[model samples]
Each structure stands twice: as C-alpha cells, then as structure tokens.
Target chain A: MLSYLPIQLIPILPIKMNYRQAKTGKLLIDILPNKCDFCGCCVGVCPEDAIELKEAEIYIIDPRCTNCAKCIWSCPIEVIKFNKEGVLEK
Target chain B: MKEEYDIIVVGAGPAGSIAARYAAQNGAFVLVLEKDRDVGYPVRCGEAISREGLEAFIKPDKRWINAEITKFGFVAPNGKKVVINLGKVEGYMLERRIFDYELAKTASVAGAEILTRAYVNDLIKENGKVAGVKFEFRGEQKQIKCKIVIGADGVESRVGRWAGLETHIDFRDMESCFQVTASNVKCDQDALFFYFGKEVAPEGYFWVFPKGKGTANIGLGVSGGVGKKRSALSYLNNNLENFFPTANILTQVAGGVPSVVALEKMAAPGIMLVGDAARQVNPLSGGGISSGMIGASIAGRLAAQSIKNNDLNYINNYHKEWKKLRGKKHDFLDKIKDGLFNFTDEQFNNLIESMLKLPEKKRTVGRFFMIALKNKPSLLKEIAKVFVV
Candidate 1:
C-alpha cells in the first residue's frame, strides 16, 4: 500500500483550494461598492447594457448580465469581479 | 418638504445642462440634479467630434476645444493608410471636462437651479406617470416634484427605465470600449487615426485621437459577443504598445458605446429620454455629444412649452421632433453599421487594396465608400433609402 497521510488531515489540508479549481462552469458577477469609485466605466463597457448607475450606485440586471465579465475589466479600480465557484477572476 | 419645479432634468451631463439651459431660457423654473461632484470629471469618452455635428447646435467656442482636427485617417488590416483633409467637414477633439462645466454654467446663468452631488435614487411614480423623484444629497434623502423630467442620465439611464420604457441594448449593437491617455506618443497632432482588423478590434475599431501636440487618447471598441473572452483594455493596450512602446499612459477609461437605433419609446406622460439614454449615438461612429445636445435642446424647449400649456403631454412633441431631427439619420447609420459589423479582416483588406488601385484624385472618401459597396450591390439600394427618405 502506498504510504498515505491520515485521511482526517485531508479536511485541513487546503481542500477548499481543490474545490475552487473544480469549478469549470457557472459565471458569477459581483460588484462591491467599497471597491467602486463611480467612474461609470462599467456602464460604458457593458455590451449587454446589464449594468446600471443610479445616484452613483452601480447595479447589475440579472437577466441581462450574461456573466460576461467585460464590465469587470472596465473598472479602473478593478472592483467589478467575475467568479467561478468563489475563485476571483476578471 | 418636496420642492416643486416646472421642469427637472436628471444627470447634468451635456444633455442635462443644455436641456436645463434651454428650459430656463424658455421661462421654465428649471432644476438640474447631478450625481457627480464634478460636472465632467473622469471622462469616459474618446472625445472626438465632427464639426458639422457641433455647428448644428453650439456656436463654436474655443473654451471647450482641445484640438482642432484638420484631417482624419484610417489604417486597414493590410497596413494601408487613407487620410482626408477636412474639406467641408469640421472636427474637434473636445475637452469634455471644461466643455461640460461651461455648459452647466450657462444653464445656471439661465436661472436653472443646479445641484451637484445630488443623486436621484428613485422615481415618485403617480398613477403611471413620473411625478417626482427622491434623491440623496449630502447623505440625506430628498424629494422634488416637477411637471416634466428629462432623462439625460446617459447610456445607463434609470430615469428612462423608471418611467417604464425599454432601456436595454442588444449585445451586437453595444460596443465595449476602453481608452487611455498616453504621454510622449508619436501622433499626428491634427489628424485622427483609426485602425481596422479583426485581430485589432473584432467587429469594432481602434482609434488614436490627439489631445495636444504630444499627448493622445488611444482606444478600441469590440462588439459584445466577441468581448466575452477578453477585455477591451487588453486589446487596446496590446495594439497601442505595439505602435508606441515607450508611451506612458496618463489615464485609463472604459465604457460602453450604444450603436443602435433610437428606443421605440423615448417619452411617456411626463418623462422624456435624451442623449445616450434615448440611443442617440451614431451607430457607425460611436459618438453622441452633438446629437445629445441637439436632442436636449428640443427636449428643453418642449418641456417648457408643456409646462406653460399645462399639458404634460407636450413631451410627445419633443419625441416626435427628435425622431425627425436625428432619429431617422441614426436609423440609416444603424443599417450601415450592421453591414460593416459583418466585414471580415479579409474584406477590410480587400477594401483598402481596391481603394489603393484608384487614381489619386478618384480615391475620395465618397469614392472609397462606393467601391466597398461594389460587391454588396444590394446595399446601394438601402444607401439610397438613407438619402431618399
């Protein structure tokens, strides 16, 4: 038998990292107000017109979002983020 | 207590400011609310505008001009260059920050009450008509009532949407645009350069607009679907660095360009959408500064008239006039952009290749366009329609 570390230790061995890489599909759009500067770049960069800026606050429309993170790169502060299973990506 | 006004315009961009000025000039108690502390700070535009478009509304003022463009040029995928002198057409690279502020100043002088850092959060809908707005100012929520609300709130306008108008743009008609101001770049100080290639822009184009003697605004726009995998910044940067490796980026900007026909409905019982909110930008050029100002002037005059007549429905006349003024022309450009959007890199190359074979004098802008339509002869009929109707 190949020498194996204790199975109980597996849970504590950064196993969450594997779960993150396992996420191959599903797109998530997250706009954190703290990271946003109200530059309105995302409003202009969005291809689907999914992003809205009202009273300086930005919000994403669910049906129109399309998970296309072009808006993410549009942010100067890089506050807009796209994720696959909580893994932060542009 | 909610303040009352004859007309209230949301978002004091060019459209809002100009609308406010016009409304006040027409004897309306006009009020303008701006979410941004600075009127035109953090500009998210390429800032290039045509002279003809500018003259159609504003009397040319040097205070807002950054560059007086004399020539405009294009580079094809095959590395061919075509530059044209500004014959009858005039163009300028605007200093939008100063330009917008000056416009706002005029509005204020015309007796429009302008409040900056005032964010309009929600609409006070009354019996299916927009009657007033609740906004946040200095961290306090405030409300104001008005007879007419001009939605000059830009491409991502909520005022229009809140008034129950369809404000969505199709992905194909939207251009995800990114731009950067670079210092010490090699640029034609008086000419604008546009680069075309699938690998360069992918259903869009890259542009270099000179701001001054040595500084330039370089950017590109890519259509929505193809941009899903990459960023507009990446495409713009990669191409820019390839040309001017030593250029230092001074500022960066990203935004969307609405390149489509006007929305089906731009006015309701008491609300009217102007500028990009109404999809008034040129589909082929991704420009709306002049068009928005034109739309705002019409809206301002109409809003004042509606209030004076005690007929809130006067907003409809504004909508109708806007269609006749710019909407019809934009609709024609929409068809042209739709056709150009499908052109492959090879076709772009062919277009340049064919144009280069023409005699020097025959290679006019008008002639170049004619040859591009040679293969797609059917498009000529539509082109004629653009003029006939």
Candidate 2:
C-alpha cells in the first residue's frame, strides 16, 4: 500500500564569478585592432569562443570570455593586448 | 696518479672527439675528458646536417641517420607554402645519441684516451699560459698537465670564461627553442618543413624534421624577448598540440641558440675554443655541428703542428684559415637573422607573400636574402660588396 508522491528535488543555483577571478591571475585576454587579418586560425583553435573576428579585426568579448589564452597562441600577428593590468609594461 | 698528454680535449662531443682523433692520429698523445656519465646523453640539437657539410670530416654512416631528406617546405606567415627540391646533396636527420658515441669510438680507435664522469673545474695556468686542467673524477679531485688545451665544451662553457675570454651572450642575440620527438604525425619523410610567422614563431621558425613514417622531430625556436615574458615551451605547447593531436611525444628539449655575430677571436696562447663555445653555429639556421667540427679539425691539426715545431706563432694561421673558410658566410647569415627578428607582423606577412610568388627552382637561401632586402637594397649591395671583396 504505497501512495504516489510528487518527487521532491532541489535546483542548483548557478555561481556568478568574475571572468578575471575564474582563471586566477594567469588568465589574459587581448584584443588586437587592425592587426588581425581575420585568419580564422584563432576562431578555429579557440577552446572557448572568447575570441571573434568582426569586420577583419579581433575582439575579445569580455563577458562571454573565460580567458583561457588559447586565442593568444592562435593569433599569428601576436598583437593581442593582455586584459590583465601591468602585464604589458615596456 | 700523475698523467700527462700532448693535447687535452675538454669535452667528448663531436668537436672534441674530432680534435682528439686528428691529434691521436698525428702521433700526439691526446686525452678526451667528458663530464657526462654517458656520452651524448640528454641530447640538445636540431639533428639535421647537410651532406656537403658531413662529407668534410667523415663519410656518411647510415646507422646513425634517422632519415635522408631531399626536399624542403617553407611556410610563410600567411599559410602559403614554398617547396624546394634538392636532387643530390641531401640533408640528414641524425640519431645524435648513437652518432656522438660512434664519434667517440673513432677517436678511441685513433689512440685517444677517453675518460667519462670527469668534470673539469679549473684550467691550470703556468707562467700566464694555459697548461692543462684540474678536474673532479669519481668524486676525487685530480689534475692533468698537457701542452695545449682545447675547449670544445658546448654553450655556456666555463672553460672559455675561466680563460679570460669575453663569452657572455646578450638576450637579444639568443633564440629560445622547444622541441619534441613526436610520432603519428602526417608529415613527408623525405621533406623538412619550416614555418615562419610572427604568429607561429615571433623571431624564429617551426620545423618538422622527419625520422620515419608517422614520426618526426617537431620543434620551434622563438626570439628571447617574446620568450622572456612567457616561454618558448609555453608557445609550443599551445600551438603544436592542436595541430598534431594524435602525435605522441617521445622526447622533449628546450634550449637557447646564439644568433649573434661570430666571435672576433677564436684562439689565445695555447687555448682554442671550438663548437658552440666558440659561437660557431650558423646564426640563421642555428646549425653548429658541421662548422664546429671543421673548426676543431683545423685547430687540432694546427695545435699539433705548433707543438711539434715549438712554434706558437703558427696558431695564427689556423685563425686565418678558419675565417677564409666560413667567416663571411656566418657574417652574412647573422645579418639576415637580425633583420628577420626585427620584422613586424605585417612586414613578415608581406615578405612571406612575396616569397611565395617566387618560382620553385629559384627559391634558394640567397633568394630569401634578396626578398628580405627588397626595400633596403643597401643590404644586398653590401652582400655583393662582400662577395666582390
């Protein structure tokens, strides 16, 4: 004599974390202006779609980016600007 | 125990062994000391040599070669490919471990005594001249006296520094490199691939020297400035793994190569530095094996001749002969290496595009120089002047 009951379940809440905090301090995202020739190499090799070429220039979508650094290696121009502060001191 | 020899070679690498072989064959007592527990262990080289260069010392022995390459593929920054066919005078990918050990055997056969696990700490100087070396052998310190000391030690050689020579290298003149012997990559066994691009390698190039079917030494050398912030190893790990996902890594090595102008001097008062210690590597290709051996051969013969005649003045002939043989070529190549390192990404892309347009048969090493000097004909004019002079 068992009665059917509605399944009691708990929903896991999505954690809100900053992009810079996710990859510790090592994560760097760079956006190169006019230097990127839309080679599609970055787009093809990026594990995360943080890098996108629009109108023949590479732009890092900061909010959607995870800062994995896959884009930096894929860019043949090597012109990507690092998102981290104090990384590009001359 | 007190031991004495006519000539003492400080390393057991190619240069040292060749020097020892020549000296021993010339009826001079020679001793070759090696610091490594095993000769040719922890190999650090691109392992490729031209046939013309190899034939100068010893004939090609197939046992030590991994592959014989007859073609070359040069890829530009824009992914354009240029293929060059070399019918004869082929290059080789060597198995250095076997090759170096075999070289030591050749020296031994010529009556040279080789001692392993002997680390030379300081050179013995008598009356302000190099006499021999004091070294640690089997955890015990020992000193051996000899007439002439040959410092064939590799890069970072303290022997040269200890002897009061200026051997310090600038970071701008160093190429940081990373390489791994990978298997299961789809590369042509008969061709060597060279990739050039700021994106690929900031200051240098990526190479694929095949060993056999489905295997090759895949590597890259980047400029030191780019490498200083990150690393050459990090750049390779990021780029190469994606292209050759299935390629299994058998061996990995990271090192620096000199891209500077050749040393103005090579010998001083009973001391001669050969191989990387002397900065004999080709600044552009970073190939030192052939040049180093050639330098060692000349040095050994001259050193022995000088000892026999008791004429130290004849040593200057060795320096003159070495410069006559290859110094100009090295100077020209150094200029090219420096020019390539300073190219911006856009300029690099333009140069590559221009090079790709060249006819296949005309794609010589000389042509690359011409293309690099397109806007500035002064370099080409200077090269021509050198040729004429």
Candidate 3:
C-alpha cells in the first residue's frame, strides 16, 4: 500500500545542473584584454557561436557558450582561458 | 541606404570586391557592405601572392607592391638554408592597406555601390530562401533587399553560418597564426623564407616575407588542436630575436587560416560563399588571395547570370566550376601537405642538406619537391596518382 502511493505526492528537489556547472562551478571563460589582438580566430572556431568581435571588444556571450574550450584552443596568443578565481589556466 | 539591389556582397575584402566588380560588370545592380572603418585596416594576412595570380585581376601597381619576390628560401631546424632563384620576379608581397582599397575602388568603377563601416548582422529570408540583409551603419539599423547574397567575409565569417552553410572546420585543419610588420628588419629583400621544425612552428612553418627597404612581415602558423603547451605568438616571440635581432615591431596581428581543400557545401539557393568564407585556401601553402579572387569572380558572374536567367541552376554551377578550376589541385596538395609536414626535425635537416648535392641550375622548385618526396613512398604514391595518369 505504501509503494502504491501517488508519485506526485512525493516532493522531489529539482536537480538542475548544466554540464559546465557540473564540472567546475568556476568555469568562467574570458579574454585577457591586453593580450587579445582582436583577430577573429576565436569567432571562427566557436561551435556554439558564443564569441563576438565588436569594433575593438570581444564578448563571450554567457548563455550561448557551452564552455567547450574550442575558443581557448583557437587563440594564437593564449588570451582566452578559463578563469578560476582570478587565476587563469587551461 | 538603398532599399533593393540585384546582388549584395559582404565584407569588402578581395573576394567581396572582386565579386561585386564582376556582378556589376555583368549588369547586376550590386552593393558591397564593409564592416571596417576603412577597407583593409588592421591587416591579418601574410600578404604574399604569385606573379601570375596578381596579374590575373589587375595590373601590378608600384604604389601597392611592397616587394617583388624573385627567390625562395627554406630553413631547416639545423639552420641550413636552401635558396631557389626564380631568375625573375614571380611573386609580390603587397601593401594590403592600399591594395584592398584599390580593389574596392575597382569594384566601384565597375558600377557597384560600396558602403564602409556597415556591419551585416542578419540575413533576410523570404519563402525559406535568403533574399536580403540587415545591417548596422552609423548607429542605425538598416535593411536592404537583394536577389543574391555573396558571403566573401573572411575566415571568421558569420554570413556563411547565417545562410545555413556548414563552414565550421576541424581544428587540425585551421592554422592558428600570428604575424607582425616590422621595420629595420634584417632579411632578404627579394626572397621569401620559410622556417620549418617542431620547435619552431609545430606542425606548421614560419615565414619571413620581405616588404622591401628593411621592412618585412615575419609570421608563423601552427596547426590547431595539437594542444601545444605554448601559443603561436609565444613561440614567435621566443624565437623572433634569433631571426631578427634588431627588428623594430610596428604592427602585430593574430588570426586563423583555414587550411582545408574546400568546404563540403559553399552555396545555397540565393546565396554563395567565396574566399576564406568557403575555406578556399590552399592546404599546403595556406595562401588564399588569388584563389579567393578567382572564386569570387566565378561566384559574382554566376550570381548575375542566375538572376538574369531566372534559374537557380546557374548559381550552383559556381561550386562545380570552382572545383574544376582550383579544387582538384587543392585536393592533391592537401594530401602532399599532410605527408610533407609530418617529417621529423632530423628528416627536415637531411632534406635541406640533400638539396645541396644538386647543381645550382638543377635545384629548381620541381627538383626540390621531387627529392623531398623520394624518402616517403606514401607521398610518392600520392604524386603518382596525379602525374602517372
């Protein structure tokens, strides 16, 4: 009888975790402004269409980015990287 | 902005200008939109082209010619050099800033309207077909209708993606590149030098293309996705002093070159992609100026013909025609590039050393490649497939 209880009655906490948030809570991809030469290498290889090269600024759209690290690999000057608490690494 | 045009070209580079020129010349009302404030500011190219390639479009001008390359130099990891004297000017390093402007001017003379500082952000579709463009100019949004849209926007082209063409490339096929135009540089004035080694470029090559009068474009391209510990620019910076100790760096650029045979699909109804947008660059040499121009010329002419005839078939001919014109050669070269670039550092040192054995007159470019291929039977077989026929 207990097993037959309605499933809707059981309150379940919604588990919402994106792949990026699951891996590292601090998976932040940003460009090192001074080192970025503004060549569109990052824009070309982005699978998610996350990077944008404006007049003199490059923006990585947060919601669009899956943080696949393709832009990180495409950069020739190593300007784009994952920022973990003010420290940047691969 | 005009409300309508027969054809619209995006990005105003060599490919866009040439496309607009040809389309307009063929009686199409053409419009070209350039995002840059100027035609060719903030140059990202190495600016090297063969003599035959440049002469095919416009007459060579003194104002735009930076250096007339008459020789070639190859440097191995061991610092050995092999120079090929072509006996006459067979290539030119262009002053791209002026050259690109001249190209756009040529298109304008051909009766195409051009707008600079106009950024195209979206493609307007009608009946599930690309029919127009929406752009931003002077802080205002503008939309224009067109019968055909040519995506000549370079490597980072968004036009291709927006039009639903598969323009994404494998990381291995993209050359992560950095280049600098420097003054007071020490290098050959009439020759282009290529430096090869894993430590130097890592699955790529370094180049010193002379721009005359103690000026040169020093650059390097490394194959992408190799997961190299250091960046291409970092590698260039580490070894730049060795090549040019007294170099005074003036301008620096970072970019990517798509080193593929060609994209699988470059065209859709009412739209076509040309130049780097189509990945029309040579796989081995990574040069695209001439190829892009050749492709745009075909695309422009066909786009006009398609609109004139009211037949979509003419537009698709661009892919077939371009393949016959340059695509086959690119496929052959792509195989050779993979085979040649995989040589170990010692193999490169030996290959350069072997070139010394041949007489100076016998050491032509053909002979140089023949000797390089003799050691690798796989590459020899690949060559036989082309020439043995």
Specify the highest-lDDT model's number: 3
Task: State each model's CA lDDT, in order.
Answer: 0.78, 0.73, 0.85
| Tens-digit lDDT string for candidate 1 (A1-90) | 324877787678654342222122433777887656565546655556566675457777655766666666445345677765554433
| Residue-by-residue lDDT tens digits, candidate 2, A1-90 | 123433342232334444343333434665556554443334433434344442234555444556655545434345555565523322
RMSD of 3: 8.1
Off by over 4 Å in 3: A1-27, A84-90, B382-389
lDDT of 1 by residue, B41-132 (tens): 77878998888877765677877787888777778887888776655437899888888888888899999988888888778888888888
- Model 1, B191: alpha-carbon shift in Å? 1.2
Give residue A56's error in model 1 in angstroms: 6.3
Summing lDDT over every window of 10 consecutive residues in candidate 2 chain B, give the lowest-scoring window: B167-176
Q: Alpha carbon lDDT of residue B278, candidate 2?
A: 77
Please report the candidate that would top TM-score against the real structure.
Answer: 3
For the second chain, the TM-scores of the candidates in order are 0.95, 0.95, 0.97
Over 4 Å off, model 2: A1-90, B375-378, B381-389
Predicted complexes: DockQ each: 0.20, 0.02, 0.41
Question: lDDT tens string, model 2, B210-268?
Answer: 98868898888776467546666666876676567888999986555666655677777
Q: Candidate 3 lDDT (Cα, whole model)?
A: 0.85
TM-score of chain B of 2: 0.95
